[model samples]
Target chain A: MHVPTPHTPLPRRPFDRSSFVLSATLAILAVLTIYGFTTFDTNGVDMDMALDMLGDNAKTLFFAPGLSNVTIEGLLKNLGVTVALGFLTTVLGAVIGMVFALASALNLAPVWLSVVVKAFTAVVRAIPTVLWVLIFAVSAGLGSVAAVLGMTFHSAGYLIKAYAESFEEVDAGSIEALKASGADWWQVVGQVFIPSSRAALMSWTFLRFEINFSTAIAMGAAAGAGGIGFDMFMASGFYLNLREMGAFTYAILIFAVLLEYVATKLHTKTMQG
Target chain B: MTILHVDNVRKTYGGNSYALDGVSFSVEKGEFVAIIGPSGAGKSTLLRCVNRLIFVTSGEVSVNGIAVTGLSNPSLRRLRRTIGMIFQHYNLVNRLTVLENVLHGRLGYKSTIAGTCGFYTASEKNRAYEILHAVGLHEHIYKRCDQLSGGQKQRVGIARALIQDPTLMLCDEPIASLDPSAAKIVMDTLRDINTRLGITVVANLHQVHVARDYATRIIGVNNGRVIYDGLPKDLTIDIIQKIYGSEAHDLILADGDTHGTH
Candidate 1:
């Protein structure tokens, strides 16, 4: 069973330059980010206070006695609101992102326009999602409307990059065949690009939906948007109801896992067919 | 009647060298013409110019006496609708069904909305099914195209091109990617399609024997210029050597079917 085959051995995998550069850049970025975070202190806390807080949090996390006070109906309503926000933002982002993605695809759009859109999306992606929500709160006031618009804006930026990359990765031969068929620009996009990239678009949309779900929760907590996150924020920050936070956390984790399972199944099915 | 005419066509890529230099040819209705050449000999460049897939740097190309060069976008699209082009790799949308891929052939004729929604008419669907059957792929009609084998994929490519009801069909190395047996089947299908439809055909071919067997006439190209143009029977061994240079022996004799397999 342990005998070696009398054939040439497989070539050793090389640590390629691009991977090396990637890891090196990531290492540097991580160090710098840690240092930057260190500069913004949350007012120094002694080790004793940290230990006490950790003990209290751990007990609440393990036992979750506040589960008795948590009404299933109230919890379900807030969870539904959070899920709706995530769904709405993802759908709207995909719609708007698709239009911009087409214009941002290198081969499809003119150079100047594509460059401008690409630059704009990069900036949008660079900003944190919570910061975007807070910025919008200043104008639209702290509410669910601001949360929806903020999440949609940031989600559009994320989906734009994903959709554009998907479109660009489409096989050149398929595009060439359509172009030579004398199909107009719109026809080519409608018939060729969209169909060829359908699976990729779906996969990207699913990934963005996961991201938006987390961001929607953050928006609800940070910007006073109405969702389970707002209630959890109150329980943790104002009332210090650790047990309620634990329950909400468990619910969020279960929903996330369910969504992920569904996405993976759909992705595999689409890839195979 | 003449269906295509190219006069002194030259395509340059911002340099002194030309991809196609002074290429001139004319095709009458129902002629099966094959352009044979070595790699990088500009055979593809020449074929692309006839359909205006790539514009020529200088000179003229006309189809049915209409100037293909310098035509407006709409005019060019209208011109292209009448001509069908197939590829070596069988460029089908793999995610689409076999019928849907074939229906794409009519995209040039349909409005953007119709093409987008895939509103193939009843007659068009019937015609596509018939074409699929003709290509011996009727059972695979509903299957996604990626499920097919290489030869079967190319058959779908042929059916797609045929659905356009094209007057002129241009094939760029259609059999290059296929295996020996698959190559023979594809070549036979192309030959049958040519004879049955009486459509004028222009094909780019790499294999000498395949072109000689399938093409009524062959044009040899080298260094972006035509070196020989005559009936396939008139193509001498010496001429083949001249066209392919040092690579002729390995390419033709090694295939062991220089006299045409089928």
Candidate 2:
């Protein structure tokens, strides 16, 4: 009679936590280096000019309370255009990005198609938003359309990459089940994949809005599109409108904070879901 | 009448190791056949080939005498509507309600426009509810699939498959992920479906005892080849040993005394 020997156990490998720490440190250093290079400027500082501007702004601001009596309609009209431009560019970019992202997702596309889409997205994302804005401003002859087009192009590039990653991370088994049930490709996408990724997609959309809003402000400044950013540039150029420049700068900061708060809330809700 | 015929099918991934090698089998109109094998034995591949989920490299597969391999997309979609499948993982869209998941089974029958608009007829919705009740998940119809237990989710999967009103049901390790009692329940449910609906079932099972108990016929596969194909009673220690190799003893259930080999 032959007795069967017990199976040999595989050797255990110890976990190494150093790789995680090293990668994180490298990432932080990379960010710091990029920031340092971008902000590096070797120039003389003028303390007297800065003090004069601040003092003049403080004096004008103290007396400018009565300026609120000027037409409220003008302010409202300016705000309407800014809000519309921001919202429209963000929505258009999100919709177009979502379409391309779905086409590019590795799980949805054939290997060759996925490769083509990834290459296309990489090229699109390599061009910075500010550069796109400058090109559009010069080519399109400087208006709201230029700002909108620039924001849409740049935001679409970033959003397409993010959305593709989200789609790729959807549960493979769910999609396989839908296919096995004989659902057509579109039905599987619409029913299972879209529903499962709804929270992530919505969160991404909100985050994109925040990014697009800032881009819209900057693009408006570059293209001379009459938003808060354009107003800031004009005030800074005039040299006498220090109070207006301060107010516009404050407005931009407030807008950024508000949008960031909304984005954070949306992210929290998506994670909770 | 033969409901499905897989004729000398071959599948080779990367043109070397055979996932399925010249495998041939047939299912009668209402026969329940269980396929038993170890891991990587081409059991799942064979079932997927029936529905063309993974295309076969060569050979022919037909459902109800209609050839499936060469059919166009629309024709294949029509053919798949008639053959329901259940998976070991249940594979329910975790975010969707149980009712919605069941109703998805009707996508093949609905027109593309109607499916996109989600305009299911009242009768179809009624049928979905009826199947949900049949699978004993009527109360959980409104709940998301992820919240359900494994056994309950498998029941919903059964309901979803049943809603397709398929003539032939293919299950790939339907109870492999379940506890022993849950596995029994799932097997009993499949057996009941086969008997009551007169639907042909081709299931891949890991447990030999469950295969013997539920299957009218047992087919044993080893290394992408069908080594034995016969009635459940004919499955012997020698055949099990040949199919499972060194792991043959693992296939034997603790309460396998009924087969008279203890």
Candidate 3:
């Protein structure tokens, strides 16, 4: 028996250094340009006035003995209202958004229906959440309902797009098998598409809830709903109390942490199963 | 006793090459026929056309003497209920239980409201159980589909087709994905069903020995057309060489060998 010798390796090409140098130089120049534009100062008088107000508010808060108790109570009440608004708006948005998403998914609906739904979602998302809140406040009057509707509209737009993408990612083979087995169109959607993507849909819904929570806070301030943002505005204008403002700010932070924890738990549990 | 008739069936995709080129054949009731051919030789397209899964470009397919090509969507769906199809991948809903997947075969018979509510009648449930038992999967009915082995999953697929109680069964490479032992089991099960229930069966298969073992009639396809149709014993080496051309020797196996070990 004869043994064969291994072949020698071919020469490797040298690395090109010019592309890296050019990319790094361009990135640094872009950063410098953005920094120079943003730092250009035109509001010196406005800055001075804001500093004066903050100093006065701090002085008052330091002198007040009962400030801590009042701030705590206010923070709790504001947090409760914010959570309630977020929950209500998210539920409404999810129901309507799921319908639109299903209608738009290519695997589920006709071509014309999918196109119409995509256009509708695009238009809805184009309007800012703050603008919706302002419009509702002006037309429907200042209240929690206006704030909730504004948040729901924006959330529905975002969720419809996300849910539709998720629905499209479902296995095409399962759907084809269902259709070939004499299943009706609706049957194919319910049994095949829904079950395959249930975990992904749940994760997307939880993610939307976190976004909607923050949106509710901002919309509440714009629409005069009784939430933490409203308390922050009132404390700034009427009492000028630094402790109250700090407490409300801290409350927003706490809410964000709680929502993050819940979302993480949900994602982990779903993946485990 | 003719159960299915295909008259000049032709299927052309993208207006260029034909998947099936003007092929015509009839299946008698209770007969077990196997379509053996090379890959992309129109075996699957011909099988799909029988159930109207893929629309025939220029032909008519009649099931139980009723014309299926000209039927509307609703009528076509109704016609499909009488025909059962099996796939190479098994195609069971992975997230659903084996029993529920089998029960899906009754979607054509169930009302829209009933299907939406996830309700199946008592007799239908019993029939599903009976079919599962017949396929030797009764003990695994409540298990999720992904939990089963390859052979077991294919058995569940067969059970699902059986629950339809179809007049004709169309199987597209039903045993191509299994090991030798498992493939033998599935083939034997199909043969047993054909003998007992007397339901007409048309299967697409790649193995010549498998076709000879289970099928009474064998049809050879090459380049989108049927080149041979006769008894299994009459399919000599010369005809095999013509059908497969360059790789004809690979198609031959020992006669009456079921386990694929010979």
Report the lDDT tens digits of candidate 2 across residue range B1-262. Answer: 9998989999999858999988998889889999988888999999999999989999999999998889899888988988899898898888888998898888888877776556689999999999888888889999988899999999988888888889999998888787777777888899999999998999998778888889999999999899999999999899999999987875564435322211
Interface RMSD (Å) of candidate 1: 1.2
Compose the digit string of candidate 3's lDDT tens values, residues A87-112.
88888888988999989999888999
Best by DockQ: 1
What is candidate 3's DockQ?
Answer: 0.52
Look at candidate 2 and tell me the lDDT of residue A112: 88
Ranking under DockQ, best-scoring first?
1, 2, 3
Off by over 4 Å in 1: A1-53, A65-70, B255-262
Docking band of candidate 3: medium
Docking category for candidate 1?
medium
lDDT: which candidate is best? 1
Chain A structural similarity (TM-score) per candidate? 0.81, 0.74, 0.78
Instruction: Please list the residue runs of candidate 3 whose C-alpha ends up more than 4 Å from where it truly belongs after superposition.
Output: A1-26, A29-74, A135-138, A141-143, B247-249, B253-262
Listed in order, each prediction's TM-score against the native is 0.90, 0.87, 0.86
Candidates in descending lDDT order: 1, 3, 2
* Candidate 2 colliding pairs: none
TM-score of 1: 0.90
Residue A61, candidate 3: Cα error in Å is: 12
